[model samples]
Target chain A: MSYALSTLWFERQRYLPAVLAVAFSCLLIALQCGLLLGLFSITSIPIDESSADIWVAHPDVPSVDLGIPIPEAWQSYLAVPEIAHTEPYIEGFAYWKKPTGGTELVLIIGARLGPDSIGAIRQLTPELRMLLSETSSAVIDEGEFTRLGIEKVGDTAEILGKRVRIVGTVSGLRSLAGPYLFCSLDTARKFLNPPPGQCTFILGKCHDKEDAPKVVERLKAHPRKLYPFTTQDFSFHSQMHWLTKTKAGIALGLAAALGLLVGAVVTSQTLYSATVASLKEYAVLRALGIPRWRMAMMVVSQAFWVGIAGIAFAIPTIFGIAFVGAEVGAKIMLPYWLLIFATSITLVMAMLSGLFALRSLRMVEPVTLLR
Target chain B: MRADGLPLTPSMKAWGLTRSYGSGDTKTYALRNVSLEIYPGQIALLMGPSGSGKSTLLAVLSGLLHPDAGTVLTLDKDLWAMNERQREAFRLEHFGFIFQGYNLFPALTAREQLEMILKWGTGCSARDATARTSDVLTMLGMSKKAHLRPMQLSGGEKQRVAIGRALIKQPNFVFADEPTAALDWKQGQHVIELLRAAAHDQGSTILVVAHDARIIPFVDRVLHLEDGILYEGEERPMELYGGPTAPSPGYIAQ
Candidate 1:
């Protein structure tokens, strides 16, 4: 065995407490962050999956929830040579009639279902296409279906005083702040029936993503006065608007930050205490001709192993939490990149703590071992 | 005095060594112009009163402490003039140490302790180090307790394990500070014989600092010290009992 491995093995018993502490802290941070990211994904599923490269709305459209109505003529104006296609989308809330004749409020989104449809609902699940193909068919997010106790396919529900059929269930398309229901444009317009020629927003897709900025600028200068945003800009605005304007988003973000800070502090303190407790052993090792850098390596290696163990423990714990949440009709989705990010953060925190704690080794004098 | 006059061949030499701790009026002298030569294949015992510099002299000779005003040459290389890293490497490669309490790592068994020393001090591979550790433990009569931790062994067994650890690398010299101070008469005698056999049979130089006096007869030469001054050769046998009869001065009977 190498010197580091031998030294670690020799002192494995002494280091176990510190390793467990760090691992537990990492698990807490990963689970907290994972839950928060999962919630954020649920909130933005519609916007993230939109086919439009740009969105045109009235000035200062509050959010997707509070979309402002614009002239349907704006769609034709936005369909310039630079733009590939443009379509109008409507968003509103409606009371859905349960199979038992009870009623529940849900957020409703309306879009074309053909090739030109933004296909936000279909992006959630391929099965949604079959549901949207029928004129009166509507797709309800799995969370909404469970919350309202609507089980069988082919069940009919009343949306905004209009009858609609529940043809399919889409996964991960629910909004925690509100239930989500998806239906085609014609059915939605018949239900909403705003004054003739008005829609919530006009969504435009460009031939190339690179052409998005130009299309947005051209639409912004249209004679009718509209606010245009590229898809990326619109997504950012929506996310920031929710984070800054809503209490739920702010509370979740703050809780996540606190979890990260607590994890870092707990891990760092545990490592420091372990180092102090083993100071004499470190002196003996130094006296035996182990280099300072090698001593530092021992601490860092211990931290690294602890971090790995914590992640190993955390993966299953997070999945369990998500599963439990799903059983109760809560929408929780863990993205792959979020887990990767959490692990990276955990490892970096561990390394930083190791570096800080190993500084104690430098103060050790070999002569102290003689005493 | 030099070892040239005697038939013994010297392995470590100290010339006019001096060391003091602290500074100004509070300065305390731990060693004062002390000089001694320890020869190969012999055990040298350092006897002294409390605060008489036996530990300081051992530290200087072993390169664990730098002498304030003198030279310590081990195997003909000046120890104090070397940098810290160089001195550490030199000590690891050439010196072995046995402290009073054995100082074995609590987490490791006796065999692991020996193997660690061999692996670190000699850069030996794991298999070779383990083999060497087993051989040394067997030679030291500690093979049965090889897997036991220090706490599991009796006082004498622990000391034997410590001896095995010290000799695992087969260094040229061994420096021990009061190896038997914590042992009873029987255990102390066994430890002394173990050190003697290690020096004679293994051709290694052994230097021990102690005031125990019980193990003095087994040593090849005795260097006595008083108030940081060294006196070569043995003192008058009566003078050995001049102070308190305990192992160390001020050490109350328990």
Candidate 2:
């Protein structure tokens, strides 16, 4: 074992605060970001819970729910052999005149009700699809009944003065900005009343899902001004739109930065005091002609080991807390990339803390040991 | 004469050394025009009362502290003439130190304390460091306790580990400042014997600073300092034996 590690292990009590501080930083960064990701993930539900491999929409379309109407004829633009199927999808926000006399905004998501449809969400089972086939029939989230001011399936509500009846309900498909109203493309066309022969988006399915990007890139080269994104990319793009537009990313970033600052302070101070405690011993080494950088390396390596130990302590705790949050109906998304990002930044903060702690080494003058 | 039938020369020579602290009215001298020579294969004890110039002179000679005035020539190089980096390199190559307290790191084992110097200072391979550490531990009579940390060892054993750390590199010069001050007479004697062996057996120059007069019989020569002045002797001057008057200038022990 390295001298630094041995010292850290032997004096673990002395270094525990720094370790816990680092763990706290990692935990805060990861959990805050995870919670935010989970919260914003609802914004991309239309893109995520669909069979489409690629979504081709108007250039101005910012998010799935806020898409602009594009010519349905754009389906011909994706007529490559890689694209096996294509269909028009419609989504827009409209006020639902609840029967109880209050208006709640609802996003109307419309797609083909076919068994092998590319644009319909996977949650629309054959039975729900048959129900949605009825004119002006819609599917609502079971959890959003209170928000929509309705009690159960088959409840009648009016959208833009047109009467609509909820045919079924699905679990866990709740929206962030507004509750989702799932229905057939014709029903969405009647409610939204876009220009005839135009649709909100044109979604396509590739023979092999991995070929979606290549197909999108090919469609991008065409003269038409359109936006094409693979399903995963579209989901991320929609989530990022909401994240930045709502400024939640900035809030979470500041919280994570504050966590890093706390970790740095505690870690730097801990290393500084530990070095001070060993000042006399280091003075002896300095007197023996050992280079000061060698001692600096020892302190920095100790910081590195402290970072590793803290990360080791944090990863499992993050998953545990996230699990608990999930059980309590609070979604906390801990993706692999977010975990890597949180850990890497926290480790860098630890190393920089080590650098900050090096100022204490200047006090190690061998002349003081003589007295 | 050396064992090889060659004449011996001073391994370290310093002349006209002076150092002080504070400035102007608060200025006080720690060393004044102190001069000395230490030869290889010799253990010299530097004895003085509190505030004498012993440690100051030791610091100056060891290239640890810059003297206000004077030059120390060791191994044919001016010790203070080199820049800070060069001087530090020189010290790494040739200097070893033992201070009043056993300054071993509390977490490292006795063997690690000694091996750290070899590995970090000399960048020696781990295999070679372990070998040298084993040999030094054996010489210090600390091989059995090499696995123990400072807290696990007795005071004398800890001091022995410090001694082992100093001698591990087989340095040309070993400067010890009250190495035995924390040990009983028996342990202190053993510490002195280790330094003596390092000098006589390994041909290293050893300079020890201490207050205990009992150490007189163990070293080859004795030097006394009083109020920034230095004096050399085969033994301590009689003035230090409770004589009435202080030893005059140029006083030498008979």
Best by lDDT: 2
Give candidate 1's iRMS in Å, 1 decimal: 3.4
The residue-by-residue lDDT of candidate 1 on B71-128, one tens digit each, is 8878989989899889888877878888776666666788887887776667778899
Ten-residue region with minimum lDDT total, candidate 1 chain B? B245-254
For model 1, what is the alpha-carbon lDDT of residue A38?
A: 58
- Candidate 2, A1-371: lDDT as tens digits: 99999999999999999999899999999999999999999999888999999999899888888999999999998889999999999989999998888999999999999999988889999999999999899998889989988898878999989999999989889889989999999999989998999999999999999999998888888898679999999999999999999999899999999999999999999999999999999999998889999999999999999999999999999999999999998899998999999999999999999999999999999988887
Give the TM-scores of the predictions, in the order they appear. 0.71, 0.96
Can you tell me which runs of candidate 1 are displaced by over 4 Å? A1-20, A45-108, A113-183, A187-257, A369-371, B1-7, B236-254
CA lDDT for candidate 2: 0.91
> What DockQ does model 2 achieve?
0.84
Give one digit per residue, the lDDT tens place, for model 2 in B1-254: 66798777989888788899999999888887777778999999998889987888888999988999988999999999999999999999999999998988999999999999999999999999999898889888888998999999999999999888888889999999999898999999999999999999999999999999999999999988877777786444556554323333432221
Q: Against the true two-chain complex, what DockQ does each candidate achieve?
A: 0.22, 0.84
How big is the positional error of residue A25 in model 2, measured in Å on the Cα after superposition? 0.5
State in Å the error of residue B14, model 1: 1.3
lDDT of 1 at A212: 89
Candidate 1 lands at a TM-score of 0.71
